[model samples]
Target: MKVAIEGCCHNKLEEIYKALEHIESVENIKIDLLLICGDFQAIRNTEDFKSLSVPAKYRTLGSFYKYYTGELKAPYPTLFIGGNHEVISYLWELYHGGWVCENIYFLGYAGVVNFGGLRIGGMSGIYNHWNYNVGHFETLPYNESTVRSAYHTRKYDVYKLAQIRQPLDIFLSHDWPTGITNFGNVNKLLKTKPFFGPDIATGKLGSIACDELLFKLKPKYWFSAHLHVKFSAVVYHDERTTSYSESKEMSSTSVENPDEINIDFDEELNNPDEINIDLKDGVNQEEKNKESNNEKTLQDYIIEDDKKEQIPCTKFLALDKCLPDRDFLQIIDFPEANGKFEFSYDEEWLAITKATQEYLTLSSNAKPLPPDNEIQKKIEEELRWVQENISQIEAGLVIPNNFQPTAPAYGQQQTFILQQPFKNPQTEDFTKLLKIQNKINPEGQSPIRQD
Candidate 1:
């Protein structure tokens, strides 16, 4: 089945609409599903950073629902998963007792959905970075209280997935698993002071818990979008066996001669698959090997061929042509360039004529419009009704002229006062505890660490 996956749209409604429209125009294509990885809004909260209890703001899911319901004339279904910035949108839904849209499915927290006989499991939540701060003197537990709270709230999602013993076909999440690309760098940009504070010593990006689960589950495909960068990897596991045998030749022969009732037994044994540990220059050699193997799959071959065929030009071509200064003029050039032609001009008349010619060429072999049958008549009637009631449909939905708010706008300059590290006994005691914890868990647990 074909699907279109996108993320981090960031409330660019026109762009989203254009993307959907383009996808829809692909002839004979059967797009069974649309998956959004999250970050559908430009901002998480209002200008004041205060959560909107109402759903008036375009950032809210309600706004998205209304827009999509009206504009997106898709032939298939769409799914939405939450990202970090979608917290406010989710909050609005929670206040209203969850989203009410029937067509749009919200995979809140984590859930499983079946699409065209394929099972897709989605887990949405940021990494738990609070637990690691317990021992750090630079960032205390109290300072990381927000992180702790968010982690606690999402703890159930972690536990719920642990109970899932069956493997999934596709695993979708907002953040990439640990050790995947430069996710660490992206997470660091989002971390501000006074809330878990920034620790430049360690660059962490992904969730250790999520990584553990991914390793154990071993899904066929995994999708994530938090890093805003494309990354992929294949994990592998290995199985091995060993055998040994010993015999006493002379003694056994003599015993067999005395009593030919010697008995022998053999049994097969199986062991759990053991993954090879490959440590090589900060790269996971085992994963690299698996990815190499994965690249040889049938789908990879198909995708490669599709990519080759989808190129707009069959061959490189460079051509220049000059038109006569007459109203009606024809210029001729070799037609073997194998390039799609597009026209641009410095004058309005030339541009219009070029566009018209291109349009006529495209439509030359197009199917003619159907006759005014019953269905067409009905459609026309509906169109007329829509046109008549357009104003009513637009009631209370008009875009305000001066909607800008005079509040704490985004990107406002702010100053922070960093105090010297406390030298109290409590701080020293915590520092000691942190040293031990750091030894046990050397890797920092956060979305930024994934890099």
Candidate 2:
């Protein structure tokens, strides 16, 4: 599979698609998919500006509205996650992953999907310690605080991702993992962004939740943006193993297990009752006893499962923002990928979502997650239910083209916010498939057409 990975896309859709087309013309290779890491800025109409987190002066509509309104069609299959900057009202309508347009799909606040035989997973939004444990409390006509906090990474989303035991081919995040600097060329990074020295020295950069997921998931390739720099690093899973990175500028770094690391952890993670305390491999009574006795840390509980098969290392890459002469895009060839693949709902992810939808909260405060055993049992049950109920349908696991434009499109010259959010048919259909409540909106609309 010939896949293109783009860094922060600050609403430069035309430039990005044109660049990919230029590459295709020169190389004579077909690009199968495009994965964008955050800062997507899917602004539709002028009213969406009211919900955007950006300052009023910097709020300008980008090219996505054209695609939304069917004026322009995406040249390739595109998938993206949200970042700190987004149209919160629109995104909130499809919080559990849905087609943003004809060929473009949003991975929701956090989601996993199957495309071209690859199990692609991602978590949207940047991390903020203050809002990490909160619920989805943001609403339309967003106030200053809700607008910003709405995009902040939440524990419920991260916890759902952490439960996956299967291997992930590629993972995406808007922020780099905490302590990731220790595995890369910190000296060169400091030379370029000298102001980052203090944060690097104190091991205070990047997201702690992301760091935990990196160790827990241990995906084959992890890509990110938000730092606005092109940096690459490889994280070895074993105790002490050194390997050179594909990037020649620097060598990879090996480190100890997640259990032994003593980096700063939030107060909530330290409490066993609130957070899930099982290893990625699953939980045992012995480990639970160790956790209670202070013999193991919360990071240890989230570490890789020794019994399950493990990937040697996770190759981490963070690209720069989309601009002239910036390292914003990367093309990767998966020669081993075979057969034509269509976009579909991943069985494991569907099961996870079905099992954990009740846990999705709307409160402003933190909540407790299910124990490891309970989570495992629930996932297994839902997996079977999905196979019986959804996989048997004629459409099967394929994501149907049920897109419906509920908001005003660009060029409409409308400046006022709608009294209520239009119930996107895609969201309604997706939730209907899983038999879950539509938490984002209550109304419904019919599909206009399918591509």
Candidate 3:
């Protein structure tokens, strides 16, 4: 079957739209199905997760249906599996059943589907952080909130999958199985320095349970994304047996013979090389056939004129920009300055609230008491004296001219001559700041900060 399996879409609506458009433009062959592994959107809004509510933001499945019908003109059937981001929606449906489109099937936690003779099994949802709270998983004494939450939740999902049946033709998961390459990229990018000499190698950021299952089942094809890096491989399995004997007496020995196994199972285990088709022969045959079939089909002939003048395909538009701009931004509302405000609030709520209240009670008596009306009037007059002094100090203060403060140019000699230092910051430092400043101030400098 000619099926198009999309990667983690992450709400790149434009790229997805273009992909669908290209699929529509294909002339002769029919597309059997379209498989979206997971992460269709970056986040599921309350309405998106609601049993059947449709929001105006076009985030829910209803919006997806609308967009597909309006723009994509999608002819073939589509299948969707949940990713970490879509877990909430999937769970909501699990708790309160919802309608899945006639053409679409919502493959929740674990399910199998048959598509064109291919048996596809999928697992979704990330690790369960509640495991830590429930005392099912132990947490390190100095565990970071973010890491703990992520790892705890993910591990739970992997553990749950252990009870599931194996031996499927294909396995689809959002997170790459642990031990696979590229799984460490997240920790690397986040600069999560290892603590207490712990092995960061084990923090591969993939599902360990998934890895075990893959090793045991060794499905024909396994596809996963979460790492966001491109990786492909073939796994092989080999089985070996050894004979042993148990003796109860000097002359009496019993041989424990295992069942006679077909050794060919090891040889037939699907390895990576099997999928690598040598295209040289196919290419030559296709070229020869093309010449013989120069007389185009009816549909091809009809679209030939339109194809010549058709606008350039939009699929080539750089998808990198769309990922963070159209996708990440749509869901993750990144706060300014390392999310200082949010972090501060979280710290207060999670760690400091009780202590802060205790401190407030202890310091309550130290706070100055309000003056009576007559005393307040006298204090107000005295405060005017302080205000006048403060204003006079402020007026007399010569604020340095921050505007274009000069600095020594490159390769300039440093001297004690005390000439005004040219304010040319180091090129690399300035460039880094400019990048960050440019993102914050998209339209160059503001008048207030320009100086």
Candidate 4:
């Protein structure tokens, strides 16, 4: 169960793979998977660069094109969440989560997937108060404001995570969980990015929703990025009836009735095991009521359920973005969970995926109906294939300067690939994004690979 954690990739896929290889050789341990926090910049083609919302000076085709064009393959299984900087349209296509390329998985906006007996769950994007409650209205041909709002974390995703009953072994967020600054070295951070002093000092540096879930689920490990610095902290939440966080020096030893325990943790969590709000039915009436009443804040949805059994504390780490020798990555291992675990497709995600797929088939005036037997079976097959492959994704050195066949040989399972043809000119600008990626390398001098 060896795994590697990476912070913001910013499309430096080659550097990440190289670093992992170096770690493997030095530590004499093979890393099984590489989990990236965000800003992965899956710009597979020149056309995708046009879709990016970053300033013209910052836009460039990143490492994604190598894999997209089949000139290079991923060296290890890669899993990533979305951050503020991403191609919104492409991710929206598989909003319920899918394989971006062979052995690389995108967790969508919010999702839960099991890997080798480890239940990893997380929500993508940073939180913005203005866009927190808004539906995803940012479509293609994105306008300036819409483009900026595209990556804002929404309440809908947070609500979905709030409904889960199973415990998450690892939780990932693109931004640090709020109140986490209390756990790390703020003075050291201030020395690096002095502007963050106020936010860190005031406990306003990261997402409030992330902090809420951290308390509720209490996952064993919580990983984040977007800050471009590495910081580590431990959250100690022992089994107790009262709501408290160890980082804040709040005690968790007081006992209270479990029935009233959940209601005390913000809004009424109710019976988590029994509260099933049907996705197709749309937003729950309870949620709607809360929303209409005085413009419900993000804090309104931060509910923690009363646990019948105790869960352990979560170790939080926010790694630096991918760069050479900056301590932006780590290699670690975990014990495999006991008993049978479903490695693919949570029941809730399947419902959302099925619902979205069915909605696409109907005309504007038509009422959408669930797909029939044949269609249902096909969906099931696809989900299982993605799940099983991701659960056992391979890690090996990649072949350079090779290409995939347009058509597979007879009886071979079709490799899922996005067809994106673009003219690649061997010019200075092609390596612009590959150049020193800002402040971490203010001198604009990251070493180029020999490839």
The candidate maximizing lDDT is: 2
State residue 84's C-alpha deviation in candidate 3, in Å: 2.1
The CA lDDT of each predicted structure is 0.34, 0.76, 0.34, 0.58
| Model 1 clashing-pair count | 10
For 1-451, candidate 1 gives per-residue lDDT tens digits of 5555554443433444344444446343334555666544423213312222113343333234333233333333555565554434222222101121324455545555444445556665455444322221112122333322321214334433544445566666665554442212223223421221122113244455555556555565555565433333333322210100011111100000111111111122122111121111222233235446754887876775575354321110011000111111011122222322211111211121111211111111322222325333434444344345432353311211111111112223233111221122221222242122211112222111101
lDDT of 4 by residue, 1-451 (tens): 7778888777778767877787677667777778999888777544455456666666756667667545688888778999877877566544555556666778878888776677788888888767666666665466788777778887666755754556788899987777675544556666876777666555556777787778877888888888776677666575441222334543212111122111111122122111121112222233345567776555655532233123355678777665544556876677574423223545434433432333331111323333345445555564564455432354211111112222122123234232331111111121222221111112222222122
For each candidate, how many residue pairs have backbone atoms clashing (under 3 Å)? Answer: 10, 0, 11, 0
Instruction: Spell out the clash pairs found in candidate 4.
Output: none
**Cα deviation in Å at residue 24, candidate 4?**
1.1
Q: After superposition, how far is residue 104 of candidate 1 from its true place, in Å?
A: 1.4
> Per-residue lDDT for 1-451 in model 2, tens only?
9888888887778878887887788778798999999988888888888888876666777789999989999999999998777888888888988888889999999999988888899999988877887888777668889888889899999999998989999999997887676666666677877777766555456777788888888898889988877777767676543221211222112111121111122212111111111112222223334567666666666673442246377778887766666677888878876745678898899999989988888878656889878998999999999999999898689998877777767766455455566677777788898998777677533322333
Error of 3 at 234 (Å): 1.7
RMSD (CA, Å), each prediction: 28.5, 12.5, 27.9, 17.4
Worst 10 residues of 2 by lDDT: 269-278
Q: State the lDDT of candidate 3 residue by residue for 208-308, as single tens digits.
A: 54556565546655666544433343333323211011101111111111210101111111111101221121111222344467577767745843643
- Give lDDT: candidate 2, residue 334: 82
Runs with alpha carbons beyond 4 Å of true place in candidate 1: 24-28, 42-49, 52-65, 68-75, 87-102, 131-153, 181-203, 239-451
TM-score of each: 0.41, 0.82, 0.40, 0.63
Q: What order do you get sorting by TM-score, best first?
A: 2, 4, 1, 3
